[model samples]
Target: MDGNQRETIHKIEKLLVERGLRARTIGSTDFPNVSPMKAVEQLMRQCSGAVILGFPQTVIHQGISKPNTQQEKNITDKQLPTPWNQIEASMAFMIGIPLLIIRQQGIEGGIFDIGTTGHYIHTFNLDNYDWIREPSFLQPFNEWYREVLVNNN
Candidate 1:
Protein backbone atom coordinates (compact mmCIF):
# COMPACT_ATOMS: atom_id res chain seq x y z
CA MET A 1 0.00 0.00 0.00
CA ASP A 2 1.08 3.58 -0.62
CA GLY A 3 1.67 6.13 2.11
CA ASN A 4 -1.62 7.83 1.39
CA GLN A 5 -3.55 4.60 1.74
CA ARG A 6 -1.71 3.71 4.90
CA GLU A 7 -2.44 7.08 6.41
CA THR A 8 -6.07 6.83 5.48
CA ILE A 9 -6.38 3.37 6.94
CA HIS A 10 -4.70 4.55 10.12
CA LYS A 11 -7.16 7.35 10.52
CA ILE A 12 -10.01 4.98 9.87
CA GLU A 13 -8.75 2.45 12.37
CA LYS A 14 -8.36 5.15 14.99
CA LEU A 15 -11.91 6.25 14.46
CA LEU A 16 -13.22 2.73 14.64
CA VAL A 17 -11.35 2.11 17.85
CA GLU A 18 -12.61 5.32 19.38
CA ARG A 19 -16.12 4.28 18.53
CA GLY A 20 -15.69 0.96 20.33
CA LEU A 21 -15.71 -0.97 17.09
CA ARG A 22 -13.33 -3.81 16.37
CA ALA A 23 -10.98 -3.39 13.43
CA ARG A 24 -8.24 -5.42 11.84
CA THR A 25 -5.76 -4.84 9.04
CA ILE A 26 -5.76 -7.52 6.42
CA GLY A 27 -2.81 -7.72 4.04
CA SER A 28 -3.10 -7.30 0.28
CA THR A 29 -2.46 -10.98 -0.11
CA ASP A 30 -5.76 -11.59 1.63
CA PHE A 31 -7.42 -10.05 -1.39
CA PRO A 32 -5.80 -12.21 -4.00
CA ASN A 33 -6.97 -12.12 -7.64
CA VAL A 34 -8.72 -8.80 -7.18
CA SER A 35 -11.87 -10.50 -5.99
CA PRO A 36 -13.99 -8.40 -3.66
CA MET A 37 -16.35 -11.26 -3.02
CA LYS A 38 -13.61 -13.41 -1.63
CA ALA A 39 -12.30 -10.62 0.55
CA VAL A 40 -15.75 -9.93 1.92
CA GLU A 41 -16.32 -13.59 2.67
CA GLN A 42 -13.08 -13.77 4.56
CA LEU A 43 -13.70 -10.56 6.44
CA MET A 44 -17.21 -11.59 7.37
CA ARG A 45 -15.91 -14.80 8.83
CA GLN A 46 -13.40 -12.91 10.92
CA CYS A 47 -15.07 -9.67 11.92
CA SER A 48 -18.58 -8.30 12.26
CA GLY A 49 -17.49 -5.11 10.53
CA ALA A 50 -14.73 -4.33 8.04
CA VAL A 51 -13.25 -1.55 5.96
CA ILE A 52 -11.44 -2.85 2.89
CA LEU A 53 -9.27 -0.33 1.04
CA GLY A 54 -6.82 -0.59 -1.83
CA PHE A 55 -6.30 0.04 -5.52
CA PRO A 56 -7.05 -2.91 -7.74
CA GLN A 57 -5.76 -3.07 -11.29
CA THR A 58 -8.31 -3.00 -14.11
CA VAL A 59 -7.13 -4.80 -17.19
CA ILE A 60 -8.35 -3.46 -20.49
CA HIS A 61 -9.59 -6.20 -22.76
CA GLN A 62 -10.78 -4.52 -25.94
CA GLY A 63 -11.03 -0.78 -26.41
CA ILE A 64 -9.47 2.09 -28.33
CA SER A 65 -5.97 1.37 -29.51
CA LYS A 66 -4.73 3.89 -26.97
CA PRO A 67 -6.16 6.09 -24.29
CA ASN A 68 -7.34 9.47 -25.52
CA THR A 69 -6.46 11.03 -22.20
CA GLN A 70 -4.47 10.18 -19.10
CA GLN A 71 -7.63 9.85 -17.00
CA GLU A 72 -9.14 7.59 -19.60
CA LYS A 73 -6.09 5.38 -19.39
CA ASN A 74 -6.36 5.32 -15.63
CA ILE A 75 -9.89 3.93 -15.99
CA THR A 76 -10.86 1.62 -18.84
CA ASP A 77 -12.83 -1.51 -19.49
CA LYS A 78 -10.51 -4.33 -18.51
CA GLN A 79 -10.48 -8.09 -18.64
CA LEU A 80 -9.64 -8.19 -14.98
CA PRO A 81 -12.03 -7.01 -12.29
CA THR A 82 -11.11 -4.18 -9.97
CA PRO A 83 -11.10 -5.04 -6.26
CA TRP A 84 -12.63 -1.74 -5.19
CA ASN A 85 -15.97 -2.39 -6.85
CA GLN A 86 -16.02 -5.97 -5.76
CA ILE A 87 -15.46 -5.12 -2.12
CA GLU A 88 -18.03 -2.38 -2.18
CA ALA A 89 -20.61 -4.66 -3.74
CA SER A 90 -19.89 -7.48 -1.36
CA MET A 91 -20.16 -5.25 1.71
CA ALA A 92 -23.36 -3.70 0.50
CA PHE A 93 -24.85 -7.07 -0.22
CA MET A 94 -23.88 -8.96 2.89
CA ILE A 95 -24.19 -6.46 5.73
CA GLY A 96 -25.48 -3.18 4.35
CA ILE A 97 -22.45 -1.58 5.96
CA PRO A 98 -21.22 1.50 4.18
CA LEU A 99 -18.36 0.93 1.74
CA LEU A 100 -16.02 3.72 0.76
CA ILE A 101 -13.63 3.60 -2.18
CA ILE A 102 -10.71 6.02 -2.18
CA ARG A 103 -9.04 6.83 -5.47
CA GLN A 104 -5.69 8.61 -5.20
CA GLN A 105 -4.79 11.06 -7.93
CA GLY A 106 -1.74 13.17 -8.76
CA ILE A 107 1.66 13.23 -7.16
CA GLU A 108 3.30 16.49 -6.07
CA GLY A 109 6.72 16.86 -4.45
CA GLY A 110 6.81 13.05 -4.40
CA ILE A 111 4.02 13.05 -1.84
CA PHE A 112 0.32 12.55 -2.34
CA ASP A 113 -1.75 15.52 -1.25
CA ILE A 114 -4.65 13.98 0.63
CA GLY A 115 -6.58 17.24 0.41
CA THR A 116 -6.62 17.56 -3.39
CA THR A 117 -5.89 13.95 -4.18
CA GLY A 118 -8.29 11.27 -3.00
CA HIS A 119 -11.90 10.61 -4.02
CA TYR A 120 -14.73 9.03 -2.02
CA ILE A 121 -17.88 7.17 -2.99
CA HIS A 122 -20.59 5.62 -0.83
CA THR A 123 -22.13 2.39 -2.04
CA PHE A 124 -25.23 1.48 -0.04
CA ASN A 125 -26.22 -1.04 -2.63
CA LEU A 126 -24.42 -3.46 -4.92
CA ASP A 127 -25.72 -2.08 -8.19
CA ASN A 128 -24.79 1.54 -7.51
CA TYR A 129 -21.30 0.70 -6.27
CA ASP A 130 -20.57 -1.40 -9.33
CA TRP A 131 -21.48 1.50 -11.59
CA ILE A 132 -19.15 3.97 -9.88
CA ARG A 133 -17.41 6.31 -12.32
CA GLU A 134 -13.69 6.99 -12.53
CA PRO A 135 -13.64 10.74 -11.95
CA SER A 136 -16.00 10.37 -9.01
CA PHE A 137 -13.41 8.12 -7.41
CA LEU A 138 -11.05 11.10 -7.41
CA GLN A 139 -12.97 12.69 -4.54
CA PRO A 140 -11.34 12.39 -1.11
CA PHE A 141 -12.97 9.62 0.96
CA ASN A 142 -11.80 10.97 4.33
CA GLU A 143 -14.04 13.99 4.10
CA TRP A 144 -17.03 11.82 3.36
CA TYR A 145 -16.05 9.37 6.07
CA ARG A 146 -15.95 12.14 8.63
CA GLU A 147 -19.35 13.30 7.48
CA VAL A 148 -20.99 9.90 7.28
CA LEU A 149 -19.35 7.30 9.48
CA VAL A 150 -17.40 9.28 12.07
CA ASN A 151 -19.87 12.04 12.67
CA ASN A 152 -22.93 9.86 12.55
CA ASN A 153 -21.43 7.14 14.69
Candidate 2:
Protein backbone atom coordinates (compact mmCIF):
# COMPACT_ATOMS: atom_id res chain seq x y z
CA MET A 1 0.00 0.00 0.00
CA ASP A 2 1.12 3.52 -0.79
CA GLY A 3 1.53 5.93 2.11
CA ASN A 4 -1.89 7.46 1.53
CA GLN A 5 -3.54 4.07 1.23
CA ARG A 6 -1.76 2.86 4.32
CA GLU A 7 -3.18 5.75 6.27
CA THR A 8 -6.60 5.08 4.79
CA ILE A 9 -6.44 1.45 5.80
CA HIS A 10 -5.44 2.36 9.34
CA LYS A 11 -8.33 4.75 9.61
CA ILE A 12 -10.75 2.16 8.33
CA GLU A 13 -9.37 -0.38 10.77
CA LYS A 14 -9.80 2.02 13.65
CA LEU A 15 -13.35 2.85 12.63
CA LEU A 16 -14.30 -0.79 12.24
CA VAL A 17 -12.71 -1.70 15.55
CA GLU A 18 -14.54 1.09 17.34
CA ARG A 19 -17.79 -0.52 16.26
CA GLY A 20 -16.67 -3.84 17.76
CA LEU A 21 -15.85 -5.17 14.31
CA ARG A 22 -12.61 -6.95 13.54
CA ALA A 23 -10.37 -5.86 10.72
CA ARG A 24 -7.63 -7.71 8.88
CA THR A 25 -4.78 -6.47 6.79
CA ILE A 26 -3.35 -8.14 3.74
CA GLY A 27 0.11 -8.40 5.20
CA SER A 28 2.07 -6.82 8.06
CA THR A 29 1.26 -9.03 11.06
CA ASP A 30 -0.31 -11.83 9.06
CA PHE A 31 0.34 -13.52 5.72
CA PRO A 32 3.62 -11.71 5.33
CA ASN A 33 5.06 -14.46 3.15
CA VAL A 34 2.07 -14.99 0.86
CA SER A 35 1.56 -13.48 -2.53
CA PRO A 36 -1.07 -10.75 -2.88
CA MET A 37 -3.25 -13.01 -5.01
CA LYS A 38 -3.07 -15.76 -2.44
CA ALA A 39 -3.70 -13.30 0.35
CA VAL A 40 -6.73 -12.05 -1.55
CA GLU A 41 -8.10 -15.57 -1.85
CA GLN A 42 -7.45 -16.18 1.82
CA LEU A 43 -9.19 -12.97 2.86
CA MET A 44 -12.13 -13.59 0.60
CA ARG A 45 -12.59 -17.01 2.13
CA GLN A 46 -12.69 -15.46 5.57
CA CYS A 47 -14.25 -12.01 5.52
CA SER A 48 -17.89 -11.48 4.64
CA GLY A 49 -17.19 -7.95 3.38
CA ALA A 50 -14.40 -5.98 1.67
CA VAL A 51 -13.54 -2.40 1.01
CA ILE A 52 -11.34 -1.21 -1.84
CA LEU A 53 -9.62 2.15 -1.65
CA GLY A 54 -9.88 3.05 -5.31
CA PHE A 55 -8.11 6.34 -4.87
CA PRO A 56 -6.62 6.54 -8.39
CA GLN A 57 -3.38 5.33 -6.86
CA THR A 58 -1.65 2.56 -8.75
CA VAL A 59 0.55 -0.19 -7.40
CA ILE A 60 2.40 -2.04 -10.15
CA HIS A 61 3.26 -5.63 -9.62
CA GLN A 62 6.68 -6.18 -11.08
CA GLY A 63 7.80 -9.36 -12.92
CA ILE A 64 4.41 -9.90 -14.54
CA SER A 65 4.75 -8.89 -18.16
CA LYS A 66 1.61 -7.82 -19.94
CA PRO A 67 0.56 -10.28 -22.62
CA ASN A 68 -0.10 -8.99 -26.11
CA THR A 69 -3.74 -7.96 -26.20
CA GLN A 70 -5.69 -5.63 -28.46
CA GLN A 71 -6.11 -3.22 -25.58
CA GLU A 72 -2.37 -3.02 -25.04
CA LYS A 73 -2.03 -0.72 -28.00
CA ASN A 74 -4.92 1.41 -26.74
CA ILE A 75 -3.28 2.24 -23.42
CA THR A 76 -0.81 4.84 -24.63
CA ASP A 77 -0.31 6.26 -21.17
CA LYS A 78 1.50 3.40 -19.53
CA GLN A 79 2.25 5.40 -16.39
CA LEU A 80 -0.80 4.19 -14.51
CA PRO A 81 -0.82 0.56 -13.49
CA THR A 82 -3.61 -1.36 -15.16
CA PRO A 83 -6.48 -1.67 -12.72
CA TRP A 84 -5.35 -4.93 -11.11
CA ASN A 85 -7.49 -4.27 -8.03
CA GLN A 86 -10.53 -4.80 -10.21
CA ILE A 87 -9.87 -8.49 -10.03
CA GLU A 88 -10.55 -8.48 -6.28
CA ALA A 89 -13.60 -6.32 -6.84
CA SER A 90 -14.96 -8.78 -9.38
CA MET A 91 -14.23 -11.67 -7.06
CA ALA A 92 -16.02 -9.91 -4.20
CA PHE A 93 -19.09 -9.55 -6.41
CA MET A 94 -18.87 -13.18 -7.47
CA ILE A 95 -18.60 -14.31 -3.86
CA GLY A 96 -21.56 -12.11 -2.84
CA ILE A 97 -19.40 -10.04 -0.47
CA PRO A 98 -20.38 -6.46 0.07
CA LEU A 99 -17.76 -4.16 -1.47
CA LEU A 100 -17.18 -0.46 -1.64
CA ILE A 101 -14.62 1.96 -3.06
CA ILE A 102 -13.10 4.79 -1.05
CA ARG A 103 -12.01 7.69 -3.19
CA GLN A 104 -10.58 11.12 -2.53
CA GLN A 105 -12.48 14.39 -2.35
CA GLY A 106 -12.66 16.90 -5.23
CA ILE A 107 -13.01 16.66 -9.00
CA GLU A 108 -10.55 13.81 -9.45
CA GLY A 109 -11.74 11.93 -6.38
CA GLY A 110 -14.28 9.19 -7.08
CA ILE A 111 -14.99 5.75 -8.48
CA PHE A 112 -12.77 4.68 -11.33
CA ASP A 113 -14.20 4.07 -14.78
CA ILE A 114 -13.26 0.46 -15.53
CA GLY A 115 -15.20 0.56 -18.84
CA THR A 116 -17.96 -1.75 -17.53
CA THR A 117 -20.77 -1.07 -15.09
CA GLY A 118 -22.06 -2.61 -11.86
CA HIS A 119 -22.61 0.52 -9.75
CA TYR A 120 -18.90 0.81 -9.05
CA ILE A 121 -18.83 2.71 -5.76
CA HIS A 122 -17.25 6.10 -4.91
CA THR A 123 -17.03 7.70 -1.46
CA PHE A 124 -14.93 10.68 -0.45
CA ASN A 125 -11.87 10.36 1.74
CA LEU A 126 -12.55 13.40 3.87
CA ASP A 127 -9.51 12.71 5.97
CA ASN A 128 -7.55 13.80 2.88
CA TYR A 129 -4.76 11.49 3.95
CA ASP A 130 -4.24 13.35 7.19
CA TRP A 131 -5.44 12.93 10.75
CA ILE A 132 -8.83 14.46 11.22
CA ARG A 133 -11.03 14.18 14.29
CA GLU A 134 -14.31 14.33 12.42
CA PRO A 135 -14.00 13.53 8.76
CA SER A 136 -17.21 14.64 7.14
CA PHE A 137 -17.07 12.13 4.28
CA LEU A 138 -16.81 9.22 6.67
CA GLN A 139 -20.32 9.58 8.11
CA PRO A 140 -22.09 8.26 5.02
CA PHE A 141 -19.38 5.71 4.58
CA ASN A 142 -19.85 4.52 8.17
CA GLU A 143 -23.57 4.22 7.64
CA TRP A 144 -23.18 2.18 4.50
CA TYR A 145 -20.55 -0.15 5.88
CA ARG A 146 -22.30 -0.44 9.23
CA GLU A 147 -25.35 -1.71 7.42
CA VAL A 148 -23.33 -4.06 5.25
CA LEU A 149 -20.90 -5.35 7.87
CA VAL A 150 -22.91 -5.13 11.08
CA ASN A 151 -26.61 -5.12 10.31
CA ASN A 152 -26.26 -7.20 7.13
CA ASN A 153 -29.00 -5.05 5.67
Candidate 3:
Protein backbone atom coordinates (compact mmCIF):
# COMPACT_ATOMS: atom_id res chain seq x y z
CA MET A 1 0.00 0.00 0.00
CA ASP A 2 1.04 3.59 -0.65
CA GLY A 3 0.86 6.63 1.62
CA ASN A 4 -2.56 7.64 0.30
CA GLN A 5 -4.20 4.43 1.40
CA ARG A 6 -2.67 4.29 4.86
CA GLU A 7 -5.33 6.37 6.59
CA THR A 8 -8.20 4.44 5.09
CA ILE A 9 -6.52 1.17 5.95
CA HIS A 10 -6.12 2.28 9.54
CA LYS A 11 -9.84 2.90 9.61
CA ILE A 12 -10.41 -0.55 8.22
CA GLU A 13 -8.16 -2.00 10.91
CA LYS A 14 -10.24 -0.24 13.51
CA LEU A 15 -13.33 -1.92 12.13
CA LEU A 16 -11.63 -5.29 12.18
CA VAL A 17 -10.62 -4.83 15.79
CA GLU A 18 -14.17 -3.85 16.58
CA ARG A 19 -15.23 -7.22 15.19
CA GLY A 20 -12.92 -9.12 17.57
CA LEU A 21 -10.09 -9.72 15.15
CA ARG A 22 -6.41 -8.98 15.71
CA ALA A 23 -4.97 -6.83 12.94
CA ARG A 24 -1.71 -5.15 12.04
CA THR A 25 -0.74 -2.54 9.42
CA ILE A 26 2.42 -3.55 7.58
CA GLY A 27 3.91 -1.74 4.61
CA SER A 28 7.06 -0.19 3.23
CA THR A 29 6.61 2.77 5.53
CA ASP A 30 7.24 0.66 8.60
CA PHE A 31 10.74 -0.13 7.35
CA PRO A 32 11.18 3.35 5.90
CA ASN A 33 10.39 2.08 2.38
CA VAL A 34 13.12 -0.56 2.28
CA SER A 35 11.46 -3.75 3.42
CA PRO A 36 7.96 -4.16 1.97
CA MET A 37 8.87 -7.37 0.20
CA LYS A 38 10.51 -8.73 3.35
CA ALA A 39 7.45 -7.70 5.30
CA VAL A 40 5.18 -9.38 2.76
CA GLU A 41 7.26 -12.53 2.89
CA GLN A 42 7.07 -12.62 6.65
CA LEU A 43 3.37 -11.88 6.53
CA MET A 44 2.81 -14.65 4.02
CA ARG A 45 4.47 -16.95 6.50
CA GLN A 46 2.53 -15.67 9.50
CA CYS A 47 -0.87 -14.27 8.59
CA SER A 48 -3.93 -16.24 7.61
CA GLY A 49 -5.46 -13.75 5.17
CA ALA A 50 -4.91 -10.38 3.54
CA VAL A 51 -7.22 -7.41 3.22
CA ILE A 52 -6.48 -5.34 0.12
CA LEU A 53 -8.32 -2.04 -0.02
CA GLY A 54 -8.58 -1.30 -3.72
CA PHE A 55 -8.91 2.26 -4.90
CA PRO A 56 -10.05 3.66 -8.21
CA GLN A 57 -7.29 3.97 -10.77
CA THR A 58 -6.11 7.51 -10.54
CA VAL A 59 -2.91 9.47 -10.95
CA ILE A 60 -1.45 11.99 -8.53
CA HIS A 61 0.69 15.01 -9.37
CA GLN A 62 2.64 17.14 -6.93
CA GLY A 63 5.70 19.39 -6.56
CA ILE A 64 6.22 20.14 -10.22
CA SER A 65 8.98 22.60 -11.16
CA LYS A 66 7.90 23.52 -14.64
CA PRO A 67 5.77 26.03 -16.47
CA ASN A 68 2.46 24.83 -17.92
CA THR A 69 1.55 25.38 -21.57
CA GLN A 70 -2.03 25.83 -22.77
CA GLN A 71 -1.49 23.14 -25.43
CA GLU A 72 -1.01 20.61 -22.64
CA LYS A 73 -4.53 21.28 -21.32
CA ASN A 74 -3.03 23.22 -18.41
CA ILE A 75 -1.57 20.06 -16.96
CA THR A 76 1.65 20.52 -15.08
CA ASP A 77 2.68 17.12 -13.76
CA LYS A 78 1.47 13.71 -12.62
CA GLN A 79 2.66 11.28 -9.97
CA LEU A 80 3.36 7.63 -10.52
CA PRO A 81 3.12 4.84 -8.00
CA THR A 82 6.42 3.45 -6.76
CA PRO A 83 5.69 0.14 -5.04
CA TRP A 84 2.75 -0.66 -7.40
CA ASN A 85 -0.32 -2.03 -5.65
CA GLN A 86 -1.17 -4.66 -8.27
CA ILE A 87 2.25 -6.34 -8.01
CA GLU A 88 1.92 -6.70 -4.28
CA ALA A 89 -1.62 -7.97 -4.58
CA SER A 90 -0.53 -10.42 -7.23
CA MET A 91 2.24 -11.68 -4.96
CA ALA A 92 -0.19 -12.32 -2.15
CA PHE A 93 -2.41 -14.19 -4.55
CA MET A 94 0.37 -16.31 -6.05
CA ILE A 95 1.52 -17.23 -2.55
CA GLY A 96 -1.91 -18.80 -1.95
CA ILE A 97 -2.99 -16.51 0.84
CA PRO A 98 -6.64 -15.82 1.50
CA LEU A 99 -7.59 -12.38 0.27
CA LEU A 100 -10.32 -10.01 1.29
CA ILE A 101 -10.62 -7.41 -1.42
CA ILE A 102 -12.31 -4.31 -0.08
CA ARG A 103 -13.04 -2.23 -3.14
CA GLN A 104 -14.04 1.37 -2.78
CA GLN A 105 -17.19 2.85 -4.30
CA GLY A 106 -17.99 2.15 -7.98
CA ILE A 107 -15.46 -0.66 -8.38
CA GLU A 108 -16.51 -4.25 -9.05
CA GLY A 109 -16.04 -6.83 -6.29
CA GLY A 110 -15.24 -10.54 -6.39
CA ILE A 111 -12.33 -12.85 -7.05
CA PHE A 112 -9.83 -11.34 -9.42
CA ASP A 113 -9.79 -12.31 -13.08
CA ILE A 114 -6.12 -12.81 -13.72
CA GLY A 115 -3.95 -12.75 -16.89
CA THR A 116 -4.82 -11.87 -20.44
CA THR A 117 -7.46 -14.54 -20.79
CA GLY A 118 -9.06 -13.08 -17.64
CA HIS A 119 -10.19 -16.33 -16.18
CA TYR A 120 -11.64 -15.85 -12.72
CA ILE A 121 -9.28 -17.14 -10.07
CA HIS A 122 -9.84 -17.44 -6.36
CA THR A 123 -6.76 -16.58 -4.42
CA PHE A 124 -7.43 -18.97 -1.57
CA ASN A 125 -10.15 -20.95 -3.30
CA LEU A 126 -12.77 -19.22 -1.20
CA ASP A 127 -15.86 -17.52 -2.55
CA ASN A 128 -17.81 -14.92 -0.59
CA TYR A 129 -14.52 -13.54 0.61
CA ASP A 130 -14.57 -10.08 -0.94
CA TRP A 131 -17.00 -7.26 -1.62
CA ILE A 132 -17.62 -3.54 -1.63
CA ARG A 133 -17.75 -1.97 1.81
CA GLU A 134 -21.07 -0.22 1.32
CA PRO A 135 -23.56 -1.46 3.89
CA SER A 136 -21.06 -3.43 5.97
CA PHE A 137 -17.60 -4.91 5.49
CA LEU A 138 -17.51 -7.29 8.42
CA GLN A 139 -20.26 -9.76 7.64
CA PRO A 140 -18.71 -11.59 4.66
CA PHE A 141 -15.32 -11.57 6.31
CA ASN A 142 -16.56 -12.70 9.72
CA GLU A 143 -18.51 -15.51 8.14
CA TRP A 144 -15.79 -16.57 5.72
CA TYR A 145 -13.01 -16.21 8.24
CA ARG A 146 -14.71 -18.20 10.92
CA GLU A 147 -16.09 -20.89 8.68
CA VAL A 148 -13.71 -21.33 5.77
CA LEU A 149 -10.33 -19.96 6.82
CA VAL A 150 -10.22 -20.57 10.57
CA ASN A 151 -12.15 -23.82 10.85
CA ASN A 152 -10.45 -25.40 7.87
CA ASN A 153 -7.03 -24.74 9.32
Candidate 4:
Protein backbone atom coordinates (compact mmCIF):
# COMPACT_ATOMS: atom_id res chain seq x y z
CA MET A 1 0.00 0.00 0.00
CA ASP A 2 1.09 3.61 -0.59
CA GLY A 3 1.82 6.15 2.14
CA ASN A 4 -1.45 8.01 1.78
CA GLN A 5 -3.48 4.81 1.98
CA ARG A 6 -1.53 3.66 5.02
CA GLU A 7 -2.11 6.98 6.74
CA THR A 8 -5.81 6.84 6.03
CA ILE A 9 -6.09 3.32 7.48
CA HIS A 10 -4.18 4.41 10.56
CA LYS A 11 -6.46 7.38 11.12
CA ILE A 12 -9.56 5.23 10.67
CA GLU A 13 -8.29 2.62 13.13
CA LYS A 14 -7.62 5.35 15.64
CA LEU A 15 -11.12 6.66 15.25
CA LEU A 16 -12.61 3.19 15.76
CA VAL A 17 -10.60 2.75 18.96
CA GLU A 18 -11.64 6.17 20.25
CA ARG A 19 -15.27 5.26 19.59
CA GLY A 20 -14.92 2.15 21.82
CA LEU A 21 -14.87 -0.32 18.98
CA ARG A 22 -12.13 -2.93 18.86
CA ALA A 23 -10.03 -2.68 15.70
CA ARG A 24 -7.54 -5.03 14.13
CA THR A 25 -5.22 -4.89 11.15
CA ILE A 26 -4.97 -8.10 9.14
CA GLY A 27 -3.28 -8.22 5.76
CA SER A 28 -0.33 -9.88 4.19
CA THR A 29 2.09 -8.33 1.72
CA ASP A 30 3.50 -11.72 0.80
CA PHE A 31 0.45 -13.90 0.43
CA PRO A 32 -1.77 -12.92 -2.44
CA ASN A 33 -4.54 -15.29 -1.36
CA VAL A 34 -5.66 -13.47 1.75
CA SER A 35 -9.41 -13.37 2.15
CA PRO A 36 -10.94 -10.31 3.80
CA MET A 37 -13.98 -12.27 4.94
CA LYS A 38 -11.81 -14.43 7.14
CA ALA A 39 -10.41 -11.39 8.87
CA VAL A 40 -13.86 -9.95 9.33
CA GLU A 41 -15.13 -13.15 10.97
CA GLN A 42 -12.16 -13.27 13.32
CA LEU A 43 -12.56 -9.70 14.36
CA MET A 44 -16.27 -10.09 14.91
CA ARG A 45 -15.61 -12.97 17.27
CA GLN A 46 -13.23 -10.88 19.35
CA CYS A 47 -14.92 -7.47 19.30
CA SER A 48 -18.41 -6.04 19.44
CA GLY A 49 -17.97 -4.91 15.86
CA ALA A 50 -15.32 -4.62 13.18
CA VAL A 51 -14.45 -1.92 10.65
CA ILE A 52 -12.67 -2.98 7.52
CA LEU A 53 -10.85 -0.33 5.51
CA GLY A 54 -8.69 -1.62 2.70
CA PHE A 55 -6.89 -0.14 -0.27
CA PRO A 56 -8.44 -0.08 -3.71
CA GLN A 57 -5.94 -2.62 -4.94
CA THR A 58 -6.93 -5.06 -2.23
CA VAL A 59 -10.48 -5.07 -3.51
CA ILE A 60 -9.97 -3.77 -7.03
CA HIS A 61 -7.01 -4.84 -9.07
CA GLN A 62 -7.19 -1.98 -11.54
CA GLY A 63 -5.02 1.03 -10.95
CA ILE A 64 -6.61 4.43 -10.59
CA SER A 65 -5.02 7.44 -12.17
CA LYS A 66 -3.96 10.47 -10.16
CA PRO A 67 -6.67 13.05 -9.35
CA ASN A 68 -7.52 15.15 -12.39
CA THR A 69 -10.48 17.17 -13.63
CA GLN A 70 -10.71 15.21 -16.88
CA GLN A 71 -10.32 11.89 -15.12
CA GLU A 72 -13.97 10.94 -15.46
CA LYS A 73 -13.86 11.36 -19.20
CA ASN A 74 -10.71 9.33 -19.45
CA ILE A 75 -12.20 6.52 -17.40
CA THR A 76 -15.47 6.40 -19.31
CA ASP A 77 -13.63 6.32 -22.60
CA LYS A 78 -11.72 3.18 -21.72
CA GLN A 79 -13.03 -0.40 -21.79
CA LEU A 80 -12.14 -1.76 -18.40
CA PRO A 81 -10.93 -5.35 -18.43
CA THR A 82 -12.78 -6.03 -15.20
CA PRO A 83 -15.68 -4.42 -13.36
CA TRP A 84 -13.94 -4.05 -10.02
CA ASN A 85 -16.33 -1.46 -8.69
CA GLN A 86 -19.38 -3.53 -9.37
CA ILE A 87 -17.87 -6.59 -7.73
CA GLU A 88 -16.74 -4.74 -4.64
CA ALA A 89 -20.04 -2.90 -4.38
CA SER A 90 -21.93 -6.17 -4.57
CA MET A 91 -19.78 -7.77 -1.91
CA ALA A 92 -20.27 -4.82 0.42
CA PHE A 93 -24.00 -4.93 -0.11
CA MET A 94 -24.16 -8.62 0.65
CA ILE A 95 -22.18 -8.29 3.85
CA GLY A 96 -24.13 -5.31 5.06
CA ILE A 97 -27.60 -6.73 4.46
CA PRO A 98 -27.10 -9.63 6.82
CA LEU A 99 -25.63 -7.34 9.43
CA LEU A 100 -28.60 -5.04 9.20
CA ILE A 101 -30.99 -7.94 9.58
CA ILE A 102 -29.18 -9.08 12.69
CA ARG A 103 -29.07 -5.60 14.14
CA GLN A 104 -32.80 -5.18 13.65
CA GLN A 105 -33.23 -8.41 15.58
CA GLY A 106 -31.64 -6.64 18.54
CA ILE A 107 -28.00 -7.50 18.12
CA GLU A 108 -25.89 -6.28 21.02
CA GLY A 109 -23.80 -3.88 18.97
CA GLY A 110 -23.79 -2.45 15.46
CA ILE A 111 -21.28 -2.70 12.67
CA PHE A 112 -19.89 0.12 10.54
CA ASP A 113 -18.11 -1.06 7.42
CA ILE A 114 -16.45 1.64 5.37
CA GLY A 115 -14.08 1.69 2.45
CA THR A 116 -12.40 4.20 0.16
CA THR A 117 -11.94 3.00 -3.38
CA GLY A 118 -10.07 5.36 -5.66
CA HIS A 119 -11.91 8.67 -5.14
CA TYR A 120 -15.19 7.13 -4.06
CA ILE A 121 -16.27 6.56 -0.50
CA HIS A 122 -18.52 3.57 0.19
CA THR A 123 -20.21 2.99 3.52
CA PHE A 124 -22.63 0.37 4.77
CA ASN A 125 -24.95 0.88 7.73
CA LEU A 126 -25.35 -2.52 9.34
CA ASP A 127 -28.29 -1.30 11.34
CA ASN A 128 -30.39 -0.44 8.30
CA TYR A 129 -28.76 -2.09 5.32
CA ASP A 130 -28.43 1.41 3.84
CA TRP A 131 -25.51 2.26 1.63
CA ILE A 132 -24.24 5.80 2.13
CA ARG A 133 -21.73 7.58 -0.09
CA GLU A 134 -20.93 10.59 2.04
CA PRO A 135 -18.25 10.37 4.71
CA SER A 136 -19.86 13.15 6.73
CA PHE A 137 -22.78 10.84 7.48
CA LEU A 138 -20.53 9.09 9.97
CA GLN A 139 -20.08 12.21 12.08
CA PRO A 140 -23.71 12.45 13.10
CA PHE A 141 -24.00 8.71 13.56
CA ASN A 142 -20.93 8.64 15.78
CA GLU A 143 -22.23 11.49 17.90
CA TRP A 144 -25.57 9.77 18.35
CA TYR A 145 -23.85 6.54 19.27
CA ARG A 146 -21.82 8.23 21.97
CA GLU A 147 -24.75 10.12 23.42
CA VAL A 148 -27.23 7.30 23.34
CA LEU A 149 -25.32 4.05 23.33
CA VAL A 150 -22.37 5.03 25.45
CA ASN A 151 -23.27 7.96 27.66
CA ASN A 152 -27.02 7.68 28.38
CA ASN A 153 -29.05 4.94 30.00
Lowest lDDT 10-residue stretch of candidate 4: 100-109
The candidates, ranked best first by lDDT, are: 2, 3, 1, 4
- Which segments of model 1 are wrong by more than 4 Å? 28-39, 54-88, 105-153
Residues 31-148, candidate 2: write the lDDT tens digits. 7567888777777767767766555444343433345754443323222322546666677767777766554542121124433435444545644455333555565556656656
Q: Model 2 reaches what TM-score against the true structure?
A: 0.59
Of candidates 3 and 2, the better by lDDT: 2
For residues 1-153, write the lDDT of model 4, one tens digit per residue.
566545555555565567665444344322224476554344334433223332333232344545555663322222221232344334544443211111112111112222322222333233332222244546544543454343223
Q: lDDT tens string, model 1, 1-153? A: 446445555665665666566564345325445465566566655543335443424445466544676555443443332444454445544554444443322211111123322323322222233222334432433344454454334
Backbone clash total, candidate 2: 0
RMSD vs true structure, all candidates: 11.9, 6.0, 9.3, 12.9
The regions of model 3 sitting more than 4 angstroms off are 1-7, 27-35, 56-83, 106-136, 147-153
**Model 2 lowest lDDT segment of ten:** 73-82
Error of 3 at 62 (Å): 16
lDDT of each: 0.43, 0.57, 0.50, 0.36
Worst 10 residues of 3 by lDDT: 117-126
Top of the candidates by TM-score? 2
- lDDT score, residue 145, model 4? 42
